[model samples]
Target: MKIAILGDSLVAISTAHSLLDQETDAEVHLFTERPEIGLMNEGPGIFEKWPPCPNHWISDLKSQEPSEGSNSVRRSWFEKAIAIALSERGCIIHLRTRCTDVSSVHVEVKGAGRIGSGRIPFDIVSDMRSVSETSTEWSGGVCITGGEPKLEITGNRSDGTTELWWSGPRKDTGSWLQEMKWIGEDPRESLTSEIKVGIEIARTLVDTIIQKSPGHKIE
Candidate 1:
C-alpha cells in the first residue's frame, strides 16, 4: 500500500510507524513543511506513552531514553529518531515541502531543493498536521533561556530559548477541523492521545486496503 502523510507531527510519525508495523510492505511517504524534524521543539517533554518508532528502527531504544509519565526522550532525540528511523526504512521524507492541495488519492505539494513540486499519488492521503493555532481558542507565548515554563503549549527552539503557546487543538475547532483529512479528538494532553489516534487511523487504512483488495467481499 502507498500512503502520503502530511506533516511531521508525532502523530504523523506514529501513523506511519503504526501503518508499517501492521503492513510491513506498505510504501510510506511523509511531507513536512519544516526542513527537518527535531528542529520544531527541544528539551524534555512528557508523553503518556512514547510511541516507539518501531523497535527495529532504532538499534538501541534505551539510548533514546523512554519513561512513563512526565517522561520522554529529549525532544530533539525523539523527533530525530522517528524521522530517521522512517527514512532508513525506505519511507520517503520530503522536507520543506508544503501541501498545496489534497484529494482522495493524491496530494499536490510545493517544495524546496530536491522536491521541486508534484502531485504525488497514494492509496491514501492523511493530514496529521497539528491544528493548534488554527483549530482552537489559543494564545502564543515565548519561554526564554532559563525562563520558568508557564505555558502548556510549546513551539520551536532558537538561540537559547523556546517558544510556547497557551492553547491547543480541541475536539471542536469549527471549520478548522475540516482543514485536514483526519483530526481526531483532542485530549487533556494533546501529544499523549496522538498515538492512539494514529493507530486508529492505521486500522482504518488497513481495513480500507482489505476491502479494496480484488475478490474481497463486504458482509
Candidate 2:
C-alpha cells in the first residue's frame, strides 16, 4: 500500500504514516512543513513531546520542507489526490489550525426549552452550536489565536469525498485541542516506543482502506 499523511508538522504526519506501516505492506510517505523529515531529535521522550523544529532546520531546509510552511501548505496535491481516492478512509491531522473551517453546524433543541448547538469539526458534519450560523460560516480558512491570524485551507465536500483534518480554538479560548511540541528521548535506544505505536496506527488505517476498497491498493 502507498500511504500519504499530510499535516502541519512532522510528528503528526509521522504518527499517521507509522500507524499504517504497522499493519500492512504499505509504504508511508510523510509530508510536512518542517524541514527535518527523517531527521532524528536525539533526546528523551521526543515522541511524547513533539517540539517545534529548530530555527536552523527551518532556514537551511526551507525549500525542501513541506509546502505547509507558507499558504502553499494548503496546496497538498499528494494529500488531496490520495484523500479524494480514499475519501473518508484518508485522514488529515490539522496542526495549530481551527476545525470551524472544515465542518458544518446544526441547531438542536435541548431540554428546558433551550436551544443548543453542536459542532462539526471534522469531515463529517459533526453538529456544533456555532456562534453565528450566518456570519461564522467558516468558509474562509483563517486560524485565530491570541488575536494572531493566518490563512489556511477550508474543507470542502464534493463528489462523495471528504478531506480529513483537525484543529481547535486558541489556548485562551479554553477548548480541548491537541497541541504539538517537542521533548527529548534516548536516541541511542535505536527505536523509541512511540514510533512503534505510530507505525501500528498507520498500518491499521491501511487495512481499513483495503477492506473498503479491495480492488484498489491502499498504500
Q: For candidate 2, write residues 9-104 as lDDT tens digits.
A: 223443554443354444433323333323322111111221122221122232323332122121233223222322223433222223223222
lDDT of 2 at 132: 20
lDDT of candidate 1 over 93-178, digit per residue (tens): 89889999999799998999476998888888888775644344443333443452544544333233443433444333222201
Clashes of each: 0, 36
Those runs of model 2 whose alpha carbons end farther than 4 Å from true positions after fitting are 7-29, 38-42, 45-191, 214-219
- How far is 219's C-alpha from truth in model 1 (Å)? 1.1
Lowest lDDT sum, 10 consecutive residues, model 2, at 42-51
Off by over 4 Å in 1: 42-44, 47-54, 57-70, 113-115, 133-191
Q: How many angstroms is residue 17 displaced in model 1 relative to the true structure, after the best TM-score fit?
A: 0.4
Evaluated with lDDT, which candidate comes out highest?
1
